[model samples]
Target: MSLSLCVITKNEEKNLSRCIESAKNIVDEIIIVDTGSTDRTVEIAESYGARIFYYPWNDNFSDAKNFAFCQAKGSWILTMDADEALSSVDKYKILPLLDNEDIDIYLFHTLSYMGSSPGVDTASNLNIRLMRNHKGYQYKGAIHEQICNVNQQLIDKRKVKIEDIIVYHYGYLDKAVAEKNKAGRNMKILERLLREDPEDNFHLFNMGNEYLRLREFEKALEYYRRAYRKFMPGLAHSPKLLLKLVMTLEALQMYEEELEVLERGLSCYPKFVDLEYLRACLFHKQKKYTLAIKGFKRCLTMEASPLHLRNINEVEGYRSYYALGEIHSELGDHEEAYDYYLQAIKAKPNFYMPLYRIAENLLKRGRNMDETKAALEKFFGKNLNAGAYGKLGDIFFSIGRYDSAYEYFLSAYEQMEPNPNIYYNLGMCQLYLKHYQEAYQWFEKIEGGRCCEDAVYRMALCEILSNHIENAERFIQLTPDHAYNKRSLVYKAFKNLAVGNPCGMLSDDKEESNAYVPIIFTLLNDLLKISAPEIFEKSLQLLNLIENDEVLLKLAKLYYCHGYYRLAYQEFVRSIQLFNKIDREGLRLMENIMDLSTGFTI
Candidate 1:
């Protein structure tokens, strides 16, 4: 019984060699069905002794595939794509399967890879890739086509068996180029189909998929939602359809809607790991840490191979460890968090995310500053990207190394287009170094937004510090309610002292009397080492009494202002370490204070 391998292609020059090479010794004849090729694809196929045939480019993929299958002359036919190849073990297994006359249709597992990762070990589904030529099998569908008649024929006339052989798919190699071609090809067919049958849900679904391939998510979602609305009620709740809906919701950033879709999908297909993993992500995004942890753990227990979900064993192990690390970090279990992060690195040493996260945890603990610094430096040395430089600057800023922080921040700012936050940070660094004129210039570059208010207020203070009294007073008058409002008032008082009207300044704003006094004392004492230590100790005591995080944080900054670096670092670390245990408002307040004081010094 001679075996024939048939493949359909159009400009598959790059991948055709691998496919043909894999089948060279296994088949008696090879047939290449070319829809059209303007390249050396046909020449390459001919070099492998493949009999070439040409067919007009039809809108239906199944029609093309079926046409190729019909022209094969061997007793046994194997259908494969130009981007697919048979592994040695699969080839060995296939030869024996082809010899078995009892088996009419044989299923082979397909593995698809994305990115630079290794092919996933798990096969999600089996396809009838090998069949008897005389079985009268044919393919169906126009876009995401499938072979249907063979299954019926096998059941009616002969026995069927599933082979352990696997087909490796490299279609996602150079995904951008392949996706561009696929989108163009599919859109042409789908547009024609939709023009003829506008209301067909399947046509709408195919069109949506084409749009999704183009990353035109909003338009894709419109068609998907339309398809779902038209078909969902009558259709038995399918995990596939539900998964698609959940993904659409995720892309739209409708977290609540995504959760609803996931819950519904989970109820219908409880064992589906894809749905579970997505649910976990939704929970993580919502900051529902406990639920997210539960879902991730459940996904780990599923029967599906990690590879089926586009994860290798290494990636799966690392993901589990990373998730545990994040959960523990949030729970204030720093020791456990650190261990899990190490485990994640062990699982996948080249992974940058775990290393960065682990360093962040170490910085919070304050016990591994040198180690964290080394890790960050190593990361930056290996990846000289803008993000790495920014993170390094952040580490320096956090530890009060203003000069080093400024250098790294400036490096990051210069290497990339300046973001408002980066400019604000540079401005803050200038202010800390007492470069009043330079600091004012940097702050003026900031536009008003959630992150720009503090910088704008600080710019006003720099005007006062540089003795621009009129500009200082104008800025102070224009200032609205902000975290730096109290600081602005103190700067105004300092401006008065710099001139000769301290008495007049002291008499105004009596309603802000309680807030301004300690701040003024802290600033004055910061200028005097002897009094600064005493004021620092008093502020620490006040911090203990304050129930509000904002108040505590303000007191902590006062301590820092008086050159109490150790105490300031301790307070900021405590706030960050307890981030998960606090209420939302409290967390936001602490985050803001940490952002202001830490600037990224390790």
Candidate 2:
């Protein structure tokens, strides 16, 4: 039994050498099929002692691949793409398998690396990459092409064995460029095929995939839904079709529709981890944290490798832990949430999500500025992207460090295009620092985007703060659905006072004057009602102006309620600083009282 390595190429000069080098020692002969190369790809193939054959660019990969297979002289044909290479272990396994005369077609696993994320190098799948060179074997389709109709051929010949070897695919090396090229070529072929066979479900599915690759998701959904509708009941249902439909629905943010499709698929195939994971994502997006946690937990219970689990720490099933952390955080169980987040970080050291959440919780507590800043700095070090910088700005702003917050917010905004939230934050920070003109400019940039309502309100506030009363009134009149409408009215009263309208100032009743805290508390209370009530109540009381000593007493209760045993234990450390400030203020007041009394005695 002899083995020959076969590959199809088209201007694969950058990748051909690596592909051939990996297979050089394992195979007996090398056959290369070039479908028009203007580069040194063919020359490089010849350098590696490969028999080069030329074929016209027929707009079909399977045709070119089959042609290469037909030309191979060896009994066993091992096929690979120009961007794929056999691992050393796989190389060793292939050498033994080739020598074994019992095998007809050897199925090897291909691990495709779509992007560079730690602990997630590849997604694995099995393919008949190595096969016996008989006249009966051939390939099919144009895009996402496969060697099909082989089961009967194998059974007739009595030769088929699945190998445990792996091939690493670097085809997605530069995914954006590759997707563009692939989508263009595939769309042309699929369009022609659809014209010839208008009602073919398989072609429809492939066409849908081409559109998806092009990011025309709505078009993809149309084709996928057609395929699903045309699906035959007794015939082996298409897994790819169902998966693609689910994915299209997910991309559209049609969570309810996605759930319906998943439920239908699950009714047929009960234990599908992919569907479970997708459902979990949808629930999370809807802020249905408990259901999301349940779905992710169920997915973990299924038989899957660590690599197959998305955003999960495989060792201890930490996706659920992290989700629980988020839910707890939302609910106001800061201590339990923080512990889960810590566990998630411990399970997956490089994961930035858990760390960011923990930082957010600390900022909410208001006692750990130095520690929270340090944690954020470490997070930014690891994930130095726009989102991280934006988060840092949010943290600083929360603690009233407006200058530092503005610097970070500006860095995030200018480092990238002006995102609405970044501009919104930048505008608010500027308002606080009394840079009214600059604040208005930032708000102006957000006027046309999705953040328009918030932007308009902020702009109105900036005008009032700048004592531009008439302009402020005009801007406020321009938008009717401001979220902070009551706050805006109070600000308008203040602006009226600045412009000498004593009657306008007098109209500022308790409803308008004291609206900010209640509005915030209402929103927080609603969030708590959905998730964690105790923590929400704690956050409310902390920011409430009930009493000087009452707020301090509630902070300890908040920590205790959330199971932040460690943080609760250290509450006195925080109180000591507050106590010192209070004592100094008391002394100043006492001195003033004594001076007043001495004046009366004189």
| Best prediction by lDDT | 1
Off by over 4 Å in 1: 99-103, 115-127, 150-165, 173-180, 230-238, 305-318, 330-332, 342-353, 359-602
Each model's total of backbone clashes: 12, 2
Residue 329, candidate 1: alpha-carbon lDDT: 86
Point out where model 2 deviates above 4 Å: 88-91, 99-102, 115-125, 148-164, 173-180, 232-237, 305-325, 339-352, 361-602
CA-lDDT, candidates in order = 0.68, 0.68
lDDT of 2 at 98: 66
Whole-model lDDT, model 2 = 0.68
